[model samples]
Target: MTSPEGGGPGTPAPLAPLPPSAPLPASAASDLVLPRYGAGALSDVVPSALAALGVEGEHDLLGLPPSDRYVVMLVDGLGWHLLHRHAEDAPFLTGEGRIRRSLTVGAPSTTSTSLASLGTGLPPGRHGIVGYTMAIPGTDRLLNTLRWDTTVEPLVWQPHQTAFERGVQAGVAVTTVSRKAFRGSGITVAGLRGGEFVPADSAGQATAGTVEASRRGDRSLVYLYEGDLDWTGHRAGVNSPAWRHQLSALDHFAARLRSALPADVVLLVTGDHGMLDVAPDRRVDVDSAPQLRAGVRMVGGDPRLRYLYTHEGAAGDVVATWRERLGDGALVLGRDEAIATGWFGEVEDRVRPRIGDVVIAALDETAVECRRDFPMEPLMVGWHGSLTAEEMLVPLVVAD
Candidate 1:
């Protein structure tokens, strides 16, 4: 395995020139427009895609053509900016004939929420995986979606049926190609339900599985995942050569798949979220920042964006303090304000508790790290889970 970018785990990236600051619009609540397909929220995109792929029902995101196979290669953490930056390494992607921009996952754009959203065709509000680790409503214990370690059963915790399941019920052959270990994992059960799981431990195996699915030439939906780029970026900054090498590997994999699949098959490549290099010097340890930690009960989500649950009656004070301290680097909003802003797309009744009493969205290239609690390795180097363009925006490249 390749070593990560920035120094060790918690070491932040060298600070780059800060981007222009843009606060989340005060009217964000009423103007909730789902990114990308713009049907509604992130949840609406997948179903729209399935519908376009000719899958019956309102839940299919890609509308597949009859007798045509559909392949969706979700490259974990391969942000649009990262792809454009490392175009040289991803020749097949950059040189592709047609590539379009896709919407970033919702606020605190982490893998868990985004993946759940894509898999279920529901927004974080519906799926209820809002952040990295969030408190289960009415319960003190936190729920870890990535690991699926929780008191609640994984299936019941996120009970929303997936687009894959709906497709299978509609007689569409559905398949998921990912690491062999994920075949029976809780995360897989919760997100990728109803799909025939194909174990692909290596890039070669992943490509082979995808090609084989496409060759079937029936109404098939093949979901493939490549996680190395995100892994490299998390360990090393996105600028690291190791990350670039991973991009090259993805490019080769794409080229190989394209060569193997029939021209009529449609292959859509996208990502869960983007990443930002947070330098060690810039890391604002929430534990150290009294103003940030004031009245906070728990800190969930990733470093770039965090969910701060304040003690009873301290919500207003906590929001004010965070806004004052983070200034233009982040947008601090009260719970009602966040929900009204429609940031999480129609905030469901059950999902309300998943959000923090005060939500913090990082704007510029800044991140809020918890030096005291989070594992040191994840705290360092490349961090994401924000609403910035770099982290929110992804690409939609199609190969026919």
Candidate 2:
């Protein structure tokens, strides 16, 4: 399995100039389930919730019915397909009339990107946190968005007004019920800012906090988050006994939170992304393969999705090499081709540099791991951050 280099993750190599290249054939993108940014997507959740609460300018693009209060609970890693497969473990979430539909999360289906999209009510292109980790513009260094670089201001990195902020401006009471540790984190400040933060570390606290926050005003929006399942999935495979146990606990949490909310409150449960277990044999370690490392300047994104920032004038060769080496196990595309496919939903000019010169989205159960750059990644059995149905399809369950 792949591991990180001695310099640790996000260590930069020099950037080489990349010349223009031919776009990938249309068939290259046909099989991909591209994110539906303006339609039924995670990004549309908050906007639709705000609209349901009668916020003046917010539109219910997701077609949610009218409600005075909304409790949006994001159970991290609860993919629609995963939940359906383990329905018995989560009866409350899969019960009749609970699941409205599955929503497509943003490309590079990681928590940072999806949350930014969900909070800002905009695509990754607009929000600018394009991946879990991405190159900091004009520098060889990569920014691990979750850990975040202190020098880069969160507010400046993501300048758009969040849905929570917009809801507050429109006279709606908006609150966020999440772990106390996340109250002032970079991800929260950058994407989910501008709401009353109520810290809740346990299921009981989450239930009580969500109920109380939803009653803040006649028009209220409350967002609750639980990351236990995601943490379990990463530590253990998605279908492993541990993951299933976590699913059961999550179902109980949801049931408790739902039962405690006032009758008028609408409960919407969703997830950031899904996960699939990758066998050690299925992983191709770039650190062990010189050809795979050739022309590469730095690595970003996660194992399932790789952002290969190549050296000057090396993108074409790097893309060709990766396509040839990975063969049918991955879809390798140039940056321009990737953008044209609308995976990121109309990327901004400033955001373009954050994307790699060559992007590789894993196909099937394959993973491209760089042991040296990402030491801990290869050890994790379950992974996401690609466009597969398993990684992109999150449920939007409505319980009233």
Candidate 3:
């Protein structure tokens, strides 16, 4: 190895140190278990806290010590790996809540799926809100589960009782403080229905309202959400100036919450997924790529992970074409393979059909995109919805 330029794959190449924005090399990296839903995951946070507060439920594998009150704050797209990369930007995070460990978000690592997991204390397989967009079975059209069509009832589609409902049933005071518009959204009705709805338009208001809610009862739970950080990342990539500015804003918000919350009240800050900035050239346009569309009936999920429903008897060709075309930068799998891999974490019988016959998951900076059908998505730079550590591993940064 020394004779060959004195270097090998294990040797550190002498070059300018790569910045956080630099894309990582493609190679099979170390592996981690599927998001441990019942053990350590976004899904476990509330239940763990509930167990800490003496609620009746599955024992907490996380062992949170103990706390009387909790304010669960979820910042959209705040992946654990992303936080470490830009830790300097968030002083409060790097200072008080900073730690080496992280918790996994549910599969696809998208908002709706993970939120359902968090709220219901179950994985995607059991709760059944599996992706950002899932096909309404027996229909050609894919239902944007977030926006959601009016015909479907949220409670009926996802019939599992949420943790909030359980908390309320146990006579625990539960309040949900979120965007004014989110009170009755499909996401709200399905997973976050039992808690008292408190609308807050600004971070200041949300934090302040949660503080008040904490003081109201001996046994209380308050859930808070911040979307601006995720919004900025989606619009201008996680590496963009806009996203950094938003990170600073999040730091200030975290500081405010830290200063205001009662000592007994613990704040658990987490995110649904992390994001990656996909270069324009790296984006594979399925609409324009004929091979990608050869046997595909429709496409769903998003840029990082694609759900390719196929025509009758075309799953084999489609999978081969996608893999051959996309090459090393992607993980192309059939329905059975995706489920068996536990990427979706125990796919349910009813929800199984919603998954694409062929799934294309970008392994590195590669993204599968569409310009013809979804015009806005193509323009966005930051993307998520995959199993990569950058997207699945999120912080459970705790503030006592």
Candidate 4:
């Protein structure tokens, strides 16, 4: 694969540690980096764009400079740490002034939760799409937010109006460019609705659609979604050559979009979350571990982050057992403690039960999988959705 203006793809770059930021909360666990909500976060992106577009009542929390036309591209699974690690493969993106700063993805660091935060300009607590798969209150089954169980109404599950809708109401031309298959998907209705949907099957189409939408009304906000990189990471671990090649392709796509847009248009690139390769020995299968099975009723969330719904009054035992068995490989906390740490950011009473009775966040490269519950999860090479820096820190590149 041909790389952009950066160093040759053959040149390997040293993985850089996360840039220093504000001090962590004293209450936070040693292994966790709490999501920075209401400040620099995925939720702040759209509101910041709206503010830059001169939309009234919207706050530019990210401090985005003024711009008449804005095109915000979300590159799924493009994390800040990952970008620096493979900077040679994506020269155009890592160029000086191209990256504004890093933003903390919402808790769990999963696509569904982060996307909801990005679209609604609200934390997971308010948006209600807390995880990839969460318990549907009053039901025994899990609602897969990505695949989206149609039986559940999207609007009702997440009642808040999206930032895109708010932009339209303010007379700003808002358009979303993504795969045609996602035109009216459940997640779209719940998080990204209230804007005109433009289908773009390829990178060229995405560039065309974005350029056209950016040229609309005096003030325009266009959102473009790219998921191929994330898909590649899930199938072939981020450390694989395939992922590096895909990164190069995505870099070219961004370069095309930036060059096509007018000078005055501000092009911002960001991502939902990051990923890390999980080894087979590093995984703990709950299906085979009798201690992990005791008292747990249903499993939600993903391998990296687990939500274990416990039977009545079994939450304490389940938490204790998980902490003991997993010992240092994960941080096991009850729902109240997880909320108290502000990982979910103000959990609403209505959205509380959807969280697990016992929450487990895999530390480092460890994963707690239940192959019996989610058969396909263990088969994946890459995993995310924990609070580690590798998964939680995503870039906010200002490719103007």
Candidate 5:
């Protein structure tokens, strides 16, 4: 694996915390660091690329080269640090001599929320897909954004028109390539709708779909998605042999996608969020801890960052209890404090209640989880969604 622009693989450099341009209170900086929005953000990618290619939109943040044909491929959970650490397994990504830069995903650093940011060209606050699982506000039931709980309508929950819509309106032929099962799923309707939905089950199929769409017109924009790497990371920690095998496959996939592209086309590779392996001892079961469950009506989000909904007027008690119990392992913040940190990026009035009364962001390898509430969640080996560098920093690599 080598660095972009003709160099050998650089040593794996740990991501630094998000730096603040303006003064932040010592307390706030100690607990949270918000996503860097206007500049190097995942939400800035597609919009800026489109603008460079003559399809204008609300964003033009990252100055991607102008190209008539483009393929934006997102590898789920491929954090910048993870890729750098395992560069030997991903030669194509680290070897190619193009442009490379780091990008930050939206807060809560989960799949659905990051996808919404990518498609809508907005932050978590504006897109309103704040977490993996969040409340429907004024209701006790949790709305799993990934599953798209039937109780909530996707469009009503996320009313913004997507970047796909913008491409279509500008007469740029747009296509979305992903697993066939995701064709009409709730998350798709809310975030990835408006483009030609092409069902692609394998990497070859994804490449095939993109090529077919690209040849259909003189100018084209195809979105290619692959999730097997993320699936492997979840079942077998990112450092495990299974995950390394998946990483090797992704390196080949990157080469395959590029080999099949037209000479004029530009291929961009990126991801939703990064992953970190959590040891068994680091897993804290909140369901079994009375202090964690006390005064808490429901638990939302994932293991790394948990959203706590409390009983009527018990918000204060819940905050104090979680801080006391979790101590330095987690930072217990009120909803207002989290928002004030600008993590969600100008949370809309309608989106406020969806956030928990008290949010707990795990500070290290520790995971604040409730196993029984979401049975499948706790069984995973890799976890993300925190202010940690491994969870927030992703790569934006280009091949022309």
Candidate 6:
């Protein structure tokens, strides 16, 4: 029972706990199980954003007062904690009223699930974008949805219509402002399809596009995204100066958009997911641990959160072994237990296969790494894809 590569083996040492001001857990909020926006929990938020743009829905959460314009600035990987930590860096965003809240971005907390949830206004269960990489069920090959390197046709694989499409159908002028290169990417096809695409190569360009989109009136919904913050956070630790620099840039971007948009426009800002800093020494490469790999088939997921698809009859043993090995650093649960606990939010029949037989959720920055395969220099430092408040709970900052 020697220590693992990055951190020592057995029970992992606890890092600084999340801030006391963090949002309460979903279970604490209500006794009745709420469908995740798409699977149905507090999904009204999507309609609320739509309502602000004049999209007629029985469930509108925006509650905008006759305003004909709306802008949803989705900062990639901008978690509430990260934002709160650098409030001064994000002066424009912090100066506004704080609507601090968190939303689950599905298991694995990768870009695919979070982006799909954001675009479709549905949980991963309904939308089917489950993880960073998933073996197309019944097949041995893994599909990378973000890069769209898969056998199935992108549209056919993920057929759910995006909220953007619904908004367009409801006569709201909908536009997606993002990196010019992603104008028609597979990820966009699966989740963010239906809206007019506005190509923007820089944060300033994106901010300008959002402002212009809102100014057009006649009920407009603009989706603006920034990717550098998440990129920096992943390669560099969340606390690193690089991450802070990105936050400062985000502040400037928010301010520019805030000043440029019409006063009547309701600007809502949120993120796909948060991040955690994984210690280089604590990383445990499953590739080298024979016992850990015993019954596991394909390992899919990012570092912080993992999905272990075990051999047909070995799930129980795998779970027991992992739980015994990792202790409190990771929570090992069976597929049924995970669903019963509402981690995936009312699992639909179609989504069940997408989940792993055994789910491993890292409770802290400590991640289950595959060292033999993954390098150290560029190893993931700020990792995510877990259920912790830092990874699962994102903010919903609104400005009038």
TM-score between model 2 and native: 0.93
Q: lDDT per residue, candidate 4, 155-266, as tens digits?
A: 9989999999999999999999999999889999999988799999998899999999999998899999999999999999999999999999999889888889989999
Per-residue lDDT over 262-314 for candidate 6, one digit per residue giving the tens place of the 0 to 100 score: 88887777887788787755555566445678799887766666778888999
Off by over 4 Å in 5: 1-33
What are the per-residue Cα lDDT tens digits for candidate 5 across 241-348? 999999999999889889988888889999999999888766666664455577898999888989998888898988887776665667788899888888899899
Candidate 2 per-residue lDDT, tens place, 1-400, comes to 2322223245533222122222334565554678998889999999999998888888898788899899998988999999999999999999998899999999889999998888999999889998989999989998898889988889988998999999999988999999999888899999999879999998888888888898997689998889999999998999799999999999998998888899999999999999999887678777654566889999998888899999999999999888876666679999998888888998888899999899999866778888888899888999999898899999999998
What is every candidate's alpha-carbon RMSD to the true fold? 6.6, 5.9, 8.2, 9.9, 10.4, 5.4
Model 3 C-alpha lDDT per residue in residues 1-400, reported as the tens digit of each score: 4322233555532222112333445543232236876667888888887887788764666667577788888999898888889988998977853553689998888999888988988888778887888777888988788788888789877898998888888777889999998889998898778879899999778988999988767788898888998889988889888898899989998988888888888787889899888887677677643445788888888778788889989999998877767666778899898888777677778888888888777777778776666778877889998888889899888777
Which ten residues in a row are the worst by lDDT in model 6? 13-22
* Candidate 4: 10-residue stretch with minimal lDDT: 12-21
Structural similarity to truth (TM-score) of each candidate: 0.87, 0.93, 0.91, 0.92, 0.91, 0.86
TM-score of 1: 0.87
Worst lDDT 10-window in candidate 2: 13-22
**Model 2, residue 103: displacement in angstroms?**
0.6
Better of 4 and 5 by TM-score: 4
Q: How accurate locally is residue 6 in candidate 1, as Cα lDDT from 0 to 100?
A: 29
- Candidate 1 regions exceeding 4 Å error are 1-45, 59-67, 377-379
